[model samples]
Target: MTDPMQDPGFLQDPYPTYAAMRSRCPVQPVSTGSGGHISYLVTGYAEARQALGDARLSKDTAAFFAGKESRRRLHPAVAHTMLATDPPQHTRLRKLVTKAFTTGAVAELRPFITQVTDELLDQWPVGEPFDLVARLAVPLPVIVICELLGVPEGDRPDVRRWSAELFAAGKPDVIDTASHSLADYMTGLITAKRLDPGGSLLDRLIAARDGDDHLSEEELVSLAVLLLVAGHETTTNFLGNAALALLQRPAELDHLRKNPDEVPAALDELLRFDSPVSTATFRFTTEAVTLGDTDIPAGVPVLVALGAANRDPERFPSPDLLDVDRDAAAHLSFGHGIHRCVGAPLAKAEAEISLRAVLARFPGIRLATPPDRLDWRRTRLVRGLASLPVLT
Candidate 1:
């Protein structure tokens, strides 16, 4: 078997490697410096879904390590968020977020989302080439998250900069520094919110904290930073990746244009065809668990390949092909069961509105550079282009 990371072809198009892995070794041993030598990387659809939802596979790395000396070596702050925890803590954290994602909640934000999309399109310079990532993908989510989190409009630029630093891919030192910076910033923001409560997610969280004894000041700040960063970064990748998919497949773009009603379905296909999140949030086995034929022992870190599982041919025929009409709702792009993304609905709504607005405004939009020449994020868990150049 080949190292997926070393293969440029695999980096550009991982489905082939995923297909091979799924067939040959659904449960493969993978090594990560943080978790040490571990049997990880679950590829098959059923196995991936089961692993994501399985109670036996603990999301809490701290609890998994307990009194072990190795545990202290890892970054405790990054590994202690909702993404890294199980119920009832996960459940409690998710509840505070779920309110912001209710159907009524998202519907109310639709007009705002549309407005943001239109404003971005209106500002795009015509004729000369521009980086869609800078103009649209990055700004759209940044603005939305700022509004949602009650981050003052003045601080958006700094917030975005901090988020980029925190999520800097593959760079351990940068990640560590960024994590501390974000924590410090959020601590200050939470303090401000406490002094002057405004009607925003932060204010709501502060109010909710007053009622629930479980949510500490530190936890609230940590979760706020998590939501703000994850909320924007993941969706930025989705918008960029979805646009790339449509530009690559003009027919699909045309199909979407003709049937605006297909936006929801197409979004699902876009997610599965080129999922924003390349891998699941890391999970460690609580005990020896058998996935397919491989045996993974306790304390091993596992990454469920959401991207790979979404492209499994056994689940979706011609899985590699982007078919807007395909029933892609079953894809694990938002993940499965307990740890599924809480902001999926909002993310989907934002993507649909943003994509439609971009295509409608810039009908001639296409990749300005060869797809092969496009750079990708190196250290981040997201699978996305570094910049998507386009001629509007």
Candidate 2:
């Protein structure tokens, strides 16, 4: 009878609710608030992973939204990118876009990421309390993504604003307005890239063709916008979530500082400990799918709660505990299968460099307030602190 998705308590601490749900069944029908829509929520680790990679659970947004009243008002560019399509189109888009996030390409950005992390860390006054989310977490990814995409420095502020508004939970009007604004901005930037190519990734995307198949004008715009949106928010939330978790468990933070080389490996544990992406994006059953003995009808909506799967006791022993040394590489924080996050390498690099730099820069940094008093973001998709006030 509990509305696990929308309840205020679940937003603060969903782990208990997830445990309760998983105790009964991995997949269960739950009312998803208005319009009397019942969605199949996947909470078990094995089942969640199974559901994510199953082609039966389609990612086609138009198909998923049909005959349903959705509060999300997304632009075509925002709604119909690689994240919201099936094979063929999705494969082509993923192939073209994966060029920017290759291993060598992301490795090349470490110096810049470290430099930016240090520069941002330097802004914090010694022995003074400051909001880490605003000062570091939020701006780092925005700046990094903009620099990669050739966005003007002056225009980044507006880009940040628009990107944030895209997640305006209940305000469909605000979400739609932000969606168009961001799409329009990207459209103009793409036109500019065509006229005058630059050294950034955006320039390459504009000119590159995939086996005589270049992105159509719409696909190009959508891909560009997708890169920006995808590159920005998730990393921002991950950074914030990772930092907060480390601060709470000083032992784990010390482990990274002492063994800096292991920071990269330790990132997966942090990602699993407090997953940033609460749930994977919208997916509906293309045909009847059976997950963990639960039978889902064709065309029914399904949700994979990444946060729950990461913390499931079956997949991870002592799931609630934060152990940096644990091999948490298999976590579904970046998703799985063909739809695995294209920017996973870049995101991992960002977290590693940022964590190493920040920990090194501010050794004495600690939370400015009690852990319980910290403000967590009250949204379904992203799980992060609104503002992590810390003292240097």
Candidate 3:
């Protein structure tokens, strides 16, 4: 089973494996490739939902690695992010940046998002196959998130590169290098924001850093790095998976193209079918915990298999089928409880607008290569294709 994860069959189609795993106990230890750490993977819908919000399972990577030289390569800014910490620290950090991603704020960006989608689609080479990942999925979100965060357009290529490298799963040194580089880059930008506070989201964050209720310098840099990376990475992969899902099912793709209004609602089902986030960030057990009737010892890591939970037959009938009309709202793609993804609203808006536009602009779009030939990224956490070549 350990070697199967690296197998091409498992990489292209893990859903069958997930179904087999779920048929056993929903929560059990598996070879999650956590660098020899004995990790438990939660696959049942109820178990995953419970573990996501379980207070006994901590996210404090900083405290866990304290006085231990094992993780010395991890920068402070990358280590202490909201994603890796439990409340009240997670609460304080989430509150400071929550305003920028509120529903109303995301609503205001709809027009801009559509404009960007149209602009990106405008340059498509006529009647030729192009790598959708390179031409559209990757750039659309990079442009939107960069503008939202006030990242200078010139530095975006570097930011994109560093962000991609940050997810190098097994390469510790590469991950360490990217984390430090991004942190140092953000530190300089934050200092500049202090002198000239333009009205970007980063400017607002800087104002909060200096205001009465302040964020520590490390927290500021950490939060900036988190937003810069997750703000678009998740959405980029989501779009790639979504497009692939639709291309495989011509009926479903046409159903939405005829009724574009349904595109927004369909995102939930699309996400459920093939979640971009294969597993939610791992949680460490503060004390002994029981999930899905399985007892786990204290000081162990728990990985919630979001992709499996979303496809649980018990949770959603015929989970393998993508029914756009189904109420797939409960899927764990964006996670659950307090640590749920904060940028979900923005990601959804960006995905819906971009997906709909892609369908409209190129109704004849089809995969240029065989589905089995597509390669998936090597990263363990993010589930996405290496490239999506399509003919327009």
* Best-fitting candidate, scored by lDDT: 3
Report the C-alpha lDDT of model 2 over 170-272, residue by residue, as the tens digit.
6778879998999999989988877887898888777763226777877888888888988978898999889988998899899889889999889999999
Candidate 3 runs further than 4 Å off:
1-4, 32-35
State the lDDT of candidate 1 residue by residue for 111-133, as single tens digits: 99999989888888888889999
Off by over 4 Å in 1: 1-3, 34-36, 65-77
**Candidate 2, RMSD to the unseen true structure:** 1.7
Model 3 TM-score, 2 decimals: 0.97
Residue-pair clash count for candidate 1: 3
Residue-pair clashes per candidate, as listed?
A: 3, 0, 0
Report model 2's TM-score to 2 decimal places.
0.96
Candidates in order have lDDT scores of: 0.82, 0.87, 0.89
TM-score winner, 1 or 2: 2
Best candidate, TM-score-wise? Answer: 3
CA shift of 280, model 1, Å:
0.7
